[model samples]
Target: MTRSEQLFEEAAQYIPGGVNNPLRSFAGMGQPLRFIRRADESRVYDVDGHVYIDFVCSGGAALLGHNPPLVKKAVLEAVQNGLNYEACAEAELKLAKLIVQLVPSVQMVRMVSSVTEAVLSAVCAARSATGRKRLIRFAGCRHGGFDTAEGDPSGVSLLCGGGQDVLEAQYNDLSSVERLLEENKGQVAAVIIEPLAAHMGVIEPEPEFLQGLRRLCGQSGTILIFDETVTGFRLALGGAQEYYGVKPDMTIFGEILGAGLPAGALGGSRAIMEQLAPVGPVYQADACNGNPVAMAAGFAQLSSVLNQPLLYEKLAREGEALRAGLRELFPECTVGGVGSISSLLFTPGPVKHDRDAKRGDQGQFARYFSHMLQNGIFMMPSQFEPVFLSGAHTERDVEMFLEASAEFLA
Candidate 1:
């Protein structure tokens, strides 16, 4: 057996399912999980000394690609100063300023450690500001594995917690949202969505869908929350709000903004943001809140994004090349997503919503995933996740991926 296989076997003795996250288990793929040794640029090396072109990109964190010198230098320097002072640091203001400057709707910001905390805090602030109870989240948009009142809720079931009324709507369906608004009326505190549902294998919002949500939220006095954890700093320097030209009242950012570190943030207009923490009534706190090292890495990464010209264009071009290549190679399958993110669904065509995504051939996709891995291409184990490209991925990487994909489909 391989070292990865052995390690997973041993880890299962201690860690549940032999992995920290459920998705990492590689369960039902008919193969053991690969334990990564190291990654550089667009490639990851497994413990068994096998190298593969990486499309996961540390769950969409390494936008500049794995271990960029700029972010690494900043992180090392920050560590030299200290890790977490447990008190306010200058880096906090610097990072916050950069976020506020980029995202126009985010006039104020609060840093947190994970997307889970950021989403929970944002929802709390929304509830406090609106004096309402219910939050409406779309199907297939996962904020995180939130511990709901009932324990380990999945999908729309996450809404079942704290006696807080939660509602679910369909993606790309404006009438569904409007119907919920009519039914719930003034009780809806916020409407939270992914903008681009990367969690649902990269479902982009229809222009009218987002614009309609904004209008609906405005009319209903509901706070619109954009869970940009996957799209933030990835779609653009200003994120999906700038890319799509539809802003959310509150935005939750994660991972990519931290330049491959563990980090997340909640930001919004001052009127709504003032409702969180010591500034207002809603309470949220973490011991490592605003850790200096994380802020430093974030500041460096965002600075590069803001200063670098044509970065987004390069990423988008590469992403398009990948999608186009897949469509050409596998005409039988469906391919979609936005800039720097794409997915291949084992379906004939037209995968619009969660229900549509469920119609895909899971068995075919599992076979495809195994075939790609054998060809030295590392893709998401599950069909529901996106293949993330980074600025570090070159045209050569795209070409190699296309060649491997061609071999798989052949």
Candidate 2:
């Protein structure tokens, strides 16, 4: 048996399902699950000593690629100073300042431990700012294991009473959102979405979808929140808000912010952000909020991205090349995504939202994943997730990926 399997078996005795996260379990995956030991620029090394070009990219966090020199150095330096402290650290100020300077919709930012927490806080702040109680989130846009409404497919189950005030809407369909806003009226506090809808196969917004949503929210006095977790630095230095030229009242961030560490933030105009505790009425606090080590790492990563000219241009070129190759190799499948994020769906034709994305054949995708794995390319086992192109990935890596995929089709 492989060492990874052995470790998983051992873990089942103590850890639930032999994995801390459900995705890592590789449940029902055609190939064996991987337990990684180490990672470096563009690749991950499994415990079995196998190396593969990593497309997971830490769920879109390694925008500058794995173990980035600047972020690593900053982390090590901060570690030397110590950890788990309470006092506000200087690193926090620097990172927050850098984020404010980069992201267009984020004039002020409050750090949190994870994207999940940031979502909760952002929703709460929205409600407080508008004095509304209901929230409307798009279907298929998973905002971390959130307790959402009925028939929600974003990984979290709707508990008996957990989502009484939450509402779901169709993505890329502004009419559905308009209806929700009209029906809820003053009760709707916020309309939160992954502007690019990367969670479900990376669907790009239709023309004026985001702009119309912003207009509707403004007309109804509701807060519009753009979840930039996946699209943050990977889309543009200004994120989706700047990329699309449509700004939201509040923005949620994750992934690249902490330099692939456990960190996230909620940011918005001062009027909305000041509603949080110590500044206004809404109360939100965490024992480990804005940890100094995380702050230092995030600052260094952002600084590198800022200093490096044409970084996005290079990443975009690689991403488009990969997408173009995939499209040619698999005429029967659908390839979608923008910027450095891409997706492969078994279904032919366009995928604009959750329903279209769900139409893709999962069983077929499992077979493709198994083929890629056998050929030394590691992608996310699930079809719904996106494939992030890392800055560390090179021409050779892209070539290898396309070759492996072509082999699968053959």
Candidate 3:
């Protein structure tokens, strides 16, 4: 057996599912996970020393690609000082300031260790502020693994297991949300959504739909929270809020903010954010909230994106090229979404809801994913997850991917 196979066997003995995350098990592709040894700009090296062009991009965290020199240097410097102080650090303050500046709606921010924590904290704060129990989340718009946000809330009978009172609405369908709000009536604390549903294969909100949501939240006194974990730095330096021109009352950020380190954040208007402990009643705290190394790496990454605005333009161009290539390679495939965040649905056009996405050819997608991996182009194993492209991906890489995809389609 190979070294990675041996490692997987040992890992299975200790770790449940032999993977840190459920999706990393490669169950969607019907293969064992490729244990990666190292990564550099736009590429990952497996334990067997095989290199592959990375489209996962650490699940959309490595926007500037893996181990960029500046982030690496910042992390190194932070390590020399300390890993975690267990107390507030200047890096946290700096990151907060940068986030506020970039996202005008975020007047105050609180740091956390992961997007899951950030989502939970944000919802808690929303509940505290609004004094409500219900939350409305759109179908397929995954915020995180929060109990309240898990499963199909629309009573579709495809539940993934979690808590209760999470009412579901259809994407781009304002009436679905309206019905939930009407049903809950003054009992809904918040409506959390991913403006671009990357988890459900990259379906973006129509302008009318987004505006309607904002209006509905205002009418109902419910907090509007945007989970920009994947689309934050990757879509634009300002994130999906900027791209869509629709701001949320609170925003949950992750990955790109951490510069490949473990970090997440909840930010919003000062009035709402101050509701957390040390200021108000809703208590939320973490021992390693602001790990110095993570903060340093995050600061370096955000600063790089801020300084080089053209990086976003380049990413857009690459995304367009990729989309075009995919269309040429698979004429029957449905492709859409904005900026570098895009997806190819193995179905007919007009995939606006989870039901639409459910009808996709999963068997064909499995073949496509396996073929792409075998050809040294790595994408997310699940058809539900959107493929990510980084600034590190070159035209040559795009061409290579297209070539491989053409073969797979053929």
The lDDT per prediction is 0.86, 0.85, 0.83
Model 1, range 367-405, lDDT digits (tens) per residue? Answer: 878887887889889888899898889999999889987
Error of 1 at 156 (Å): 7.7
Q: Work out the TM-score per prediction.
A: 0.96, 0.96, 0.95
Off by over 4 Å in 2: 147-164
* lDDT for 185 (candidate 1): 89
In candidate 2, what are the lDDT values of residues 1-410, reduced to their tens digit? 99988988888899988877666657777676888999999999999999999999998898888998888999999999998688898888998988888877788999999887888888888888998888888888977654344545442224211465777799999999989888888898888889998867878999999999999999999999998889887789999888999999998889577888889999999999999999989898998799898888889988998898888998889999999999999888889888789998888877788888889888888888899888999888887788888889998999999999889878
- For each candidate, C-alpha RMSD in Å? 1.8, 1.7, 2.6
Better TM-score candidate (1, 3): 1
Displacement of residue 63 (Cα, Å) in model 1 is 0.6
Clashing pairs in 3: none
Between prediction 2 and prediction 3, which has the larger lDDT? 2
User: Where is model 1 more than 4 Å wrong at Cα?
Assistant: 147-164
- Candidate 1, residue 32: lDDT: 69
Q: Give the CA lDDT, 0 to 100, for residue 265 in model 3.
A: 95
